[model samples]
Target: MIEPELTRCVASFHPGATGVTGAAKLSGGASQETWTFDIVHPSGNVGAILRRAPPGYGAAPGRAAGLDAEATLMQLAHDAGLPSPKVMHVLTPEDGLGRGFIMARVEGETIARKILRDEEFAKARPMLARQLGRVIAGIHGLPQAKLPQLRSLTATKEIEDLAREYQSFNWPRPVFELALRWLRDHDPGPSSEVTLVHGDFRHGNLIIGPDGVRAVLDWELAHTGDPMEDIGWICVNSWRFGEIDKPVGGFGTREDLFAGYAEAGRKVDPDRVMFWEVMGTLRWGVMCCGMMQRFRLGPDHSMERAMIGRRASETEIDLLRLLAPRGK
Candidate 1:
């Protein structure tokens, strides 16, 4: 049966759309959901996606920039000619569709492994890193006046936050401690030019097409911070998907990425980027441990969570490679 509220809501925002069809939940968690559907129109079925908090889920969790902010960011990016999906409509209480917004579906592959290994993305792979650098530069260069209220972060603050979260887990890893110490010692302090940092600009958040990066998805982790943080996160080894040699998402070299950023008129701080890379590595490891905690505690008690906990060691190894390279 079609959800009556959804049908009515789409009809209101989608001009000439009679209703919505094939509304399917793409993925969701306790507080958020994503749905894919088609707007039934006289001309054709227009593909769309809905991201919402569902009723009763109020306020985004810590560090989230909120759904409203996400919509605004997407719209701004699209307006700025970035490879972003067009925001179709932001849901209101009158629509009975909870919070969040509908966006034009941009078809592409988000899986890093597929983008790296699949023959279809072979041509896209080689150009991805440099292209992504330019894309990220665009994101950082977005007008400050148009940006929504977001949390401001710095390297020192992020390090403290990560350290606190790791301590809460009560799981001790000597390698993690070493990395933390390294971060503290090497902290680059505040960035001279603070800009929008796509807090998670790595593999899973990107949509790649044969032409190159088609969209930079998932703005949940976005914040105001060092732009180099985005660059470092993209270079994290975990996102490399086994192509460890290629630092830029396992697709290209840092040189190319820097070149692209320079072409976009942004200065590249190599030292700051490296500092954030170490921080990003440890951050992923702590997040994995948190997943395991959530699994064991309650709610999402799944094997995937349990397995991800095991993968924290991968970050540990990566941390060693970064801090104390055996051959280098």
Candidate 2:
């Protein structure tokens, strides 16, 4: 349904692009979609990706940063040399391809299990934690004036949001309650430096190659808040797969991550990072339940959602380790 429109769309933007080919839907729901296709050009074929919200979804409902905002952020990140895909064209009404933008596709493995166990990424594992740290610093340093209007989030507000979402499910989770209490008690107040937070900075969103992280994807959750939240989210136990010992995405230590961040001339607040780690763990747990809720009562019939929901208990174990660890 998108090829004919897509063909015309690319030709309108890319001077050399004659058309598009091999269009295939990568992922997403009815409202949002991701498609992969190659731009047929006279010189050579160019890999491209399209992220759209069909035509009728309206503006990004709820917390989404919107497709237009995503395009701007990706372009800004690319301009800042943060290993993000180069945004090529923002969809116009005349394109008839819905509301979205096109980006040059970066080749890499986004699968967590593959990047963790595959021999190709073995060398990169040790360096990723620190490298990602620097990337986060760069993101935090993005000039504020050029930034599109986004929600300004605080730790307290995020906690409240999570609590509301969890409460909406009408299922009482004891561990979740405990976490909510802890988060409120340990609220670090407002961060000294308010910058762009890459709302989701863990496994699947990172495009990794043999050398290192090739690109960061998904800016729909980007907000203005504590940059350290990014660090804590990556260190969440859910993201480490089975490598619990290696906290930094199961690759390296907090020391390495801090070292990389410090190299960017930013101070590391250990307390804030730890707090966010707890928050991230609890957030992921709540998200699992939310995903399951969607699966049980929505158009999204994804077994993956139900499977993820089953992992909600994993966060319980993680919370115990963090909030009430036994002597090692």
Candidate 3:
């Protein structure tokens, strides 16, 4: 049977919409979820996506930029002509869909492997880094007055947070400790100009197509901080997906990425980006360790978590490359 409540909800806001069809879960966990469906209308079927915390899950967990904030960001980005989905409707209690939003869907490949290896993206690959740079510039330049409240982060604060999380693991990795020390010694402190930082801006969060980046997705970790953090994050080795030589998302050069940013009237501090690169590497390593911890002691233990724990060594190698590289 069709979801009568959801159909009524769509009809309330979607002009000319008769109902909804093809409702299906895309992905989610216990607390939040994503669903794909079509808004049936006399004009045509409209592809839309639903992101929600369901009914009982009241607020997003630590550091998440709650669903409401996410919707606002997407709408802001779309309005600014950035490659983002347009928010269709924000769910209300009467909708019976819980807390979340519906947005027009943009189709593309988010898998790093295919984006890097597939011939379909061959032309797009070379253009991605530069295009993404411009997109990020747009994101950072969005009118602050119109933006929603988000967590403000600084390099010093980030380093401290990462150190605390790493220490909690209690599993000593001299490399991680060395990296941690290096970050403290080189912390850039407060940026001269802070803007919106898409906290996770690589690989899976990007939607790539034959034409290049079709859209940027996932704003759960969006925050206010150094823009360079986005640059460094996209350059992280894990996101390279085996193409280590090309630093800018394994598809283009840092020079190209920076050039695009510069063309957009923004300055790029290479030194600061380098600093965050190391920090991002260490951050991923620590996260892998956390995965292992959860696997060892959790109600959600799974093989993927176990395997990811083993991948911690991957970060270790990447860390060494960053902190103590062997001379060529």
lDDT: which candidate is best? 2
- State the RMSD for candidate 2: 1.1
Alpha carbon lDDT of each predicted model: 0.90, 0.93, 0.90
Model 3, residue 68: displacement in angstroms? 0.5
The order by descending lDDT is 2, 1, 3
User: Candidate 1, residues 1-328: lDDT per residue as tens digits?
Assistant: 3357878988887788898888899899999999988889999999998999998889999999999999999999999999999999999999777889999998999887888999998998888778888998999999998899999999999999999999999877999999999999998888899998879888877878889988878899899989999999888999889999999999999999988888899989999989989999999999999999999997999999999999999999999999999983
| Local lDDT at 38 for model 2 | 98
- TM-score for each predicted model, relative to the true structure: 0.98, 0.98, 0.98
RMSD of each: 1.0, 1.1, 1.2
Mind giving the per-residue lDDT tens digits that candidate 3 earns over 40-155?
Answer: 98989989899998888898999899999999999999999999999989988888878999999999999889999999999898888889889989999999998899999999
Model 1 spans > 4 angstroms off: none
lDDT, candidate 1, residue 68?
Answer: 96
lDDT of candidate 2 over 1-328, digit per residue (tens): 7889998999888997888899999997878999999999999999999999998789887888999999999999999999999999999999988899999999999998899999999999999989998999999999999999898899999999999999999998888899899999999999988999989999999999999999999999999999889989998988888988999988889999999999988988999999999999999998899899989998787899889889899999999899988998
